[model samples]
Target: MTSTLSRAIVNYPNRFDPGVLSELPEHLQETIQRRNNVLGPGYTLIYKEPVEFVAGHGAHLVDRDGNDYLDAYNNVPCVGHAHPHVVEAVARQMAAVNTNTRYVQESLVDYAERLLATFPEELSKISLACSGSEANDLAVRVARYHTGGEGIIVTRWAYHGITREVASFSPHLGTGSPLGPNVRLIDPPDPRLAAPGSTLAEHMRKQVRDAIDDLERHGYRLAALVTDCAYTSDGIFTDPVGYMHGVVEEVHGAGGVYIADEVQSGFARLGDSMWGFSRHGVLPDIVTMGKPMGNGLPLSGVVFRPEVSDEFGRNVRYFNTFGGSSIPVAAGAAVLDVFEMENVQQRVLENGTALRAGLEEITKDSAYVAEVRGSGLYVGVEIVKDRATLEPDRARTEDVINDLRDRRILINGTGQSANVLKIRPPLAFTSDDVTRFLETFAEVAKDRL
Candidate 1:
């Protein structure tokens, strides 16, 4: 009963119903009751009610009680939820061929080649996976095998995936989580380290150099320096183009691979570039992606320089049952088609500039807002306890989230202390939406701050 209501919450693809759905049947009422009993009488009871959602289309979600909401959280609805072209493509493919990896199918090969063309010419090979985690997990295995190394270096708060080995790469585990051996932690780039008159790119390069040097001195063979291009977890970023070059080169100097985790940062979310790594102006040996591809269908892959996989193939074998399934490939293809036809990236680029301007204007008077960082559609409003202390302000951040919900704007918080309001709406999100969000958000934030 509780899981049913939880599914009701999870399955809602758009704006959630603002009010407690009083029209629910007795069975759904019991489901909501059990949900409250298990999950406790918290936000869901008051601000967010447990309402069964029926369906979605474009940027709106309708519940069993029939309420509409402007979606700001879903990127997988790239061409808008239940896009007709995408739906038709999936239906056609489902009717034609939904085969496994064992077959030499056109859908798999065509989609693979199409995806590869999106990357640099040097990226010659691609491997299929079902999710971002699977892609990262596979990259880890390949990198370790290719470099013949044991140590892996990653960001302190980065999220790679849910699988066992990749979980070791994520330091968000906190106090009691189990972890793998040889995973080294590092702080995300602090502006203080580089300072004024110092180049951020060079600073990042120097830091990676120090990390590799320290690892070698400690008798650890470094295999890879894996990170999401955006530094999503650190809540901060090193600036300027090619900020990652020195680091990637340093990893190579230590005979390690440089893997770009593009699951969250790719598909033109950055606005200025097709891939997040493109903004860095450096090529990654391996690039993995998911979340937006297949327009919410479980389809993802790793694009790598062909030689990396060839070297690793000597020791390991990999295969996924549904990585490039017929339906998923069709969905992915439809996404590509929509991107080209709609020119969504161009709109995102323009909208991103507008969004940043609005947000900067929104938080100008708030002392709690430490910094606003990120580009394109992904923006992070960093919150601190005080300017002097720079401590995490989790409680105040929670209150602001509640306030936003009260205004019916669906936004959430992320980063180390869960203080930064991580904002990345769908590509379909407009300037008007940005303005509305800013108005509501500023009003909500002013109260809490």
Candidate 2:
């Protein structure tokens, strides 16, 4: 039987399928050739009609051919593409002074202070890194030191980062890759898997307990249970968010830490709260965030309890050359400023509510759409061959994605079968954008299905 978590994750294409790009325009063809020549191997573009974005503003992107596209697939530009506030802050800081953390930079300190304020008081210490991978790697180190354990637990198909150690914990990389000796895999808290009389919380607790037992049997003590709070890459699982409380307490009981990888769920992207962990009413011992942190600039970090870091600091020293440097720090600070100035979280709630309602109505009578669900701006439309059986339809999902691209709307499919359409738009996406997206989506669904 296919696990619920497996059904939720989209099977990312590893090899390029040339069939989709066969009829590209001459100009795009030439551009693709040039890119291939310069960019070595292992490159994959999103759509069959790959876009060479020349410029971006608000929630849209303009390709080299001057064709405009609604960019609903990018969250790195959470404040919208080329947001003036963040761009200006980065440029101004770069012009003034761009240096490492060794120097006394007031802006860096101020940004750290501002960012820390959003987190709970218990997470009093912060350490900046350049990407989600680095932050997570550091988090693993911190957990190991704090607990004197080598075991780590993650969801079966969880994706943490690209580093060697992190990759060992991310099984989604594939069967060819080997996992770390001390790492354990657990099924995500899928609501569908809950037994008739039990809750999702109970199912998840049992899963975590089983993982802990397995790790212990391997002669590895539990160090941490790292999870993507939104389960973004394992398929966006956001509902009855408080179900993970038992899992967290279980980690604590086993003397393991809970590390929340918020690369996809932080900074008001979830709409309901500032952090996804908060939505679940759980406080992580270590929280690592990236992607939207600097709003395009390279800035990610780990936020942890002061005492935890104190011990790590006493035993081992840590520093990153450009981790919390001047320019990225400035950009980070600007992101927070934009969040407040524009009232982003509340706006996300409004936009997400509208998008969800519209999607539910549009896909209600569809034969392929199994479910329409998600939180805030992050939405997923599950595509199935038969609504009654709920069997995934990857072929139809791929066709829908291409058709949406043809209509100038951007979205992608996710889940193990790549059957769920992911609709995570920028935080600044408006009511008008929502209507346009839904109209285009309905048109595409009608024509394709």
Candidate 3:
């Protein structure tokens, strides 16, 4: 059984505790109270002591008092915060026109063409949406329509989105959002969990096969197996490349399509490739992307093979009020422009390699450091109470993150125990940022771990 401490800390590892309100600055305390009064209990803030950012540029943020913070956890502004190119494109489009897809828009068509070019040849069709939730929700509908099945499989702690349909499979949302009856949870492809002689592929394939059989037992046929290729919410498991091949094979054998949720792992976040699914060497039937597509604008989309979406497209009329709007499309195009102009993929690879090496060096002698794992900019540092036991240290992980926050560095935690330090900054993160983070993290680990 999981401990109460682990369960309580799993969701928001560094969330500010309301019990310590009096310890904060008077102004922040008042602001928190006002925010709570207006936003209600649905919203939560990060860090033991929360911060309010007034501005951001590149890989840094400025607080209310003008203190600079190194941002090592945000993935929304993949190119960078307030990037001039994206800003100019959005402003220019907004000044000219901002309308829905019903209108004839050259920018939307051009952007869609360019975006689709980045994907595999078979994934030729694109459908735009406002958020990852909507994209995943639509992907579910398409999968069910294509396969004539209602069952979906997701990782045990996966977080796809918040929409009613998407959240039904997002087990990381916690107990308040119970999984749907047709949803089956499988353990993430963690190499550590693999049997001694077996490969990660074998282990994952077995789990998927078990899930399909159980779904069948419940009178539900397989529709799709959806997962974030990076496994961000499930401890950032990105090792043993091609481990998903067998899993995808199992899913296909069970008559289910594969949906790669790239909200956190797409657009060169992984350095080596544009999409995380590419790292697995498996072609997904449907690929859903969001978060970084329009820099900070609300933009998301689903790209799939024509055959998979043909029947649905022909039978059902689909339109979103502001999904493929001109302004967001312009911003997305500008992001692609940055990717080309700045050679962001190479930069991510170099910076990510240096960052991981620095982290590994710093945590080498520490007993609390279980492992350093990830690909490219998306990395995780697992924390454990005992190296031998590998028991997750949720409290220590929270302390380390909050300590970094106090030092004007921002990061977060993930996984079921919330003990994995998640360091996924913008693709623009530089060697300087990596150095600063390593030095600060070493200092914090010395004091806290």
Candidate 4:
């Protein structure tokens, strides 16, 4: 059993190192040098070999050299890479006109109406932005203004975004990066990993209350509790559905808003539902979504309670230059249209169920495999050196990931120790993709672990 304390304090190790590019192909080596000179060291690449892809089509990516790798890791192109529907919509819109939000755009309101319909009635207003970081920044400002408070709560390993304001909410950036003085970190609920006799619901309530109390003790008013619904950066704990209800209640009781960061978990990524917060059976005061909204395009925003937005609108003059503009609007509308016409939610649900089953079966035959858990298409496979001790096998995890990459199967590791394989493919991933992934994964597990 995983202790709550251990889970909260777990350190996220650096998974990819640019130094490993020593044995890279000559072209990639030259590309890396160019990237270092132009893009700087801040940018990161995946895999030991560091692939340079040229094109992607429906759950598969073609590298610069024409090698096709099965993509089991990218969620930004939610529906599928270069999906004709989204492509056509964006191109058609751009060909006609692509302007700022100040213009009268029916597509903007149309997309907003379609998106707002997906949320609970309370989340009746929308404000668009260019990325998740911007949406989260807006959410924090709205929360602070509405509650007249400055404190924020987040999971110890949570990652909201990269902007200066949002980065303060992302503790996963590690110790060198200081969180805002008003920010507090809490442990997320994990049903599969909680220690014996410890109920996740009760533990979460206690932790939330303690966090809020700590905030007040520090002379800060409670502004909001922001959480990524899937807990993606906090190790993908999606089990024990409705576990978040208690936390939400605590936030409301404290007069603080609850902001659901659904950038990685929204758009039917979790299956059966279009949004991750829906899985917890609790509604947030404000919900932020991005990444897949425009299917690879730069588009993100927040949807909040009408009253909250109304109040903010009256006081603060808020306007994003390119947000909710022509191209993103058309692309977002086409994504919604594709979801309806293609029944993406139902398909993802079915595929996810099959994936979990396959992974669970595979775990039984592997010594390094400790657990296989997730909802919809976002899954995590825990790699451990000792199943009895639950000690993470980071070395083995890295080996498996690189080996899979070598075999033309793309995936990555996540969690504090980077020992849990993060498997989130495009929504269009089919049964064939699953078979290929499982077969390749099993081979790597056997050979490397």
Candidate 5:
């Protein structure tokens, strides 16, 4: 990295400066513009205007124009953008050792043990894969093989990955059977629709019970429940905690495995815990993790109950060429170290509290804003046509995302309807950053939302 980039970290998250990109060599500018053109027309957190990135440091993303963006959309940079500690660890390991799973790599073994240390005791065996999709597929295989069942249940607006098998379990297709039969679907028990005295947890329990019964009647005993710890595809934090406990218990009671899809909600992003399942106080039989695992590296895995692994082993040969490869292990080890030394999770808790409060403050007395729900750095601002009606104003939500980008702030949207303004910033996001984002959001909403 250049000294200019080195110096940028000291004053992170500064307002993006278009001049930096302008100052790029003529060829680079042409290439950047061409690249922007290639993206064509699309709803995105970024656009052609002032679009270019040069460097990153800690909690900021610097465009080619040297404009620093407060990184609230990058979990891949969990230890913070281009963290030197992780870079150095990766470099040293790459220089010394990096090989396939066929070798005796200490990094892999060490990382596996360290990773397992953070999981629940019941989760004792792990199988590494290259991406969240691969991990999800493996988890499903393990679940079905272990349970000797063929059914899977997922929530509406659920996203596992792009793999064919995982895709079959994903509700991203919404109104299609492309995901295969025997895959039961249900809505995430969003607290907004709750009865006067029904707790979110209790409501989810009822939903899980009903789904299980319906699936059983259809001659399909569930093999597993694959769900984002938070149903993040619907929105950032669906607060799947209380409801998750019920889901897991129900799955186990039905002789199915509870597969926690921690691809989005793991590694302390929720704060106060390493895994999202920990937040629910229930141990899942299988846990599929990715997203922030290697902080953006192509690495993911499934951790399961030992008995399940033994059962799976009896049926299929478990193998992946790059599973737990040396580089991923090195990067993962560094992430774990950073998680401890920097106390990143604790920082998430602190900043999460501040950010949520700031968002709530912006929505106060506003007709455009409905509710702000989430935990830790992962959050969602529900845009509504009318708060009392709980209707999603999709167009206005899109406008909010566009306007935020126009103002040089980075953010995005989620949900099947694409209306929840998502705030899943990197764990390194700070209070001042939160204040700035909310201030811009409030300003934008006052004018258009």
Candidate 6:
């Protein structure tokens, strides 16, 4: 059954409950109290029994008691936690010079050029930012300035970012963050939801058209259609490839740009492609990325067609104090270096295939596991009360997550119902880590499901 909890609450199924703080270890209890006092209630911890990690390397994290946990959730450390290359680059650059983009920095330009090379040739102009929210915010601004429209569209449960403009379209932020009057929401491109005798692409195109019509009815001209290519928050529907083509076509037909929010699905996370939008075979007018751009460093950027940004760039003076600073750029360059040196794309493809195969094998007999779907390393295991009805079992999903945590395997949930296990580990995750994760998950499923 679906959760009865307030939609305003962030959809984190494994969120820690403060009422159980007394049951935790004495040290943890003290730590929690201090955190609440200092950090306030704005931040929420995960897991039924919160974990305090002291150190992390590659795909494993070491807790205060020296207990090791396999990391199968965090994607921020795309190349691995504390990777020496990124660490050394950031340190070296920080020691040398950490100036803003105002100063002419060769390394900064070099990093930008390298990053732009990964995208389609048309998306050559880039604007740097400190976070995904900032990148998406800039993207929206550019789209509105270029098209002179106020309307924006996104999936019903999409989580783009936290900036005021971006969050207004990011419905996954929950009911507490009201959507802007100019924003409209549509269902993710789920093939299962296609109507009888219709293809997924046709279904998505119709949805976009309907949203556009509604926006017009409300006196909002279409500015852009933004989406997280991975559909991470809408249950990770990454199948029936090339389905986004029709959706993009519909947006373009309405004189609106398509913004690919690749914060979670970019940088080879989806295995076969360097960016998630490439998998759909449709080029986005603007692309925003972050989370893993500088490994752990706060680096994000928006790359768009030069024509799309020309009006905005000429009229607006954009400057982020730390956006294209030398240190973060150096860290970003190092991340690119690792991708080339380690052949990260190929590794992700192989590892993702193996991981998905193992999970499918283990959960084949499970009544709770309705499906295992994703591209590359970004996977989602849908938990349902009944396989036939496909009713989301959020409570069972929470049990699976907490049980896996007890077994020292880290994972979280996503989707509108918060019933899909989000298995997105660092790109550095290896075959051995995959095996370990599957073995533990199998045991957890057997015991709990």
For candidate 6, the per-residue lDDT at 327 reads 86
What's model 5's overall lDDT?
Answer: 0.78
Model 4, total clashes:
0
Q: Deviation in angstroms for 159 in model 5?
A: 0.5
| lDDT against the true structure, each candidate | 0.76, 0.85, 0.92, 0.86, 0.78, 0.91
Backbone clash count for every predicted candidate, in the order shown? 1, 6, 0, 0, 8, 0
Q: Specify the poorest-scoring 10-residue window by lDDT in model 4.
A: 5-14
Roughly what TM-score does model 4 have, to 2 decimal places?
0.95
Candidate 2, residue 22: Cα displacement in angstroms equals 4.7
Q: Return the TM-score for each candidate structure.
A: 0.87, 0.95, 0.97, 0.95, 0.87, 0.98
* Candidate 6 per-residue lDDT over residues 319-372, each given as its tens digit: 999999888899899999999999999999999999999999988888878899
lDDT of 2 by residue, 136-172 (tens): 9999999999999999999877889989989899887
TM-score of 3: 0.97
What ranges in model 3 sit over 4 Å off? Answer: 1-10
Predict model 1's lDDT versus the native: 0.76
Let me know the TM-score candidate 1 reaches against the reference structure. Answer: 0.87
Error of 2 at 29 (Å): 1.9
Inter-residue clash pairs, candidate 6: none
Residues 20-52 of candidate 4: C-alpha lDDT, one tens digit per residue: 667777888888888888884345666667787
Error of 6 at 50 (Å): 0.3
* Tens digit per residue, CA lDDT, model 5, 125-158: 8889989999999888888888878889888778
Please state the error at residue 424 of candidate 4 in Å. Answer: 0.7
Candidate 5 vs. truth: CA RMSD? 7.8
Candidate 1 residues 1-449, lDDT tens each?
56644543432122235344566567776776676578743134322333355777765666666776556556677767888889999999988879887887887788888888889999989888889999999998998888889788887777788788887887664433344567777667656558678777677777777777777787879999998887776674524566677888888889999999988888898888878889878888899998888888998889889888886766667878899778888999999888898898997899878877888888877778888777888887777888667787866766776677656565566676777776777777777777778788778876887
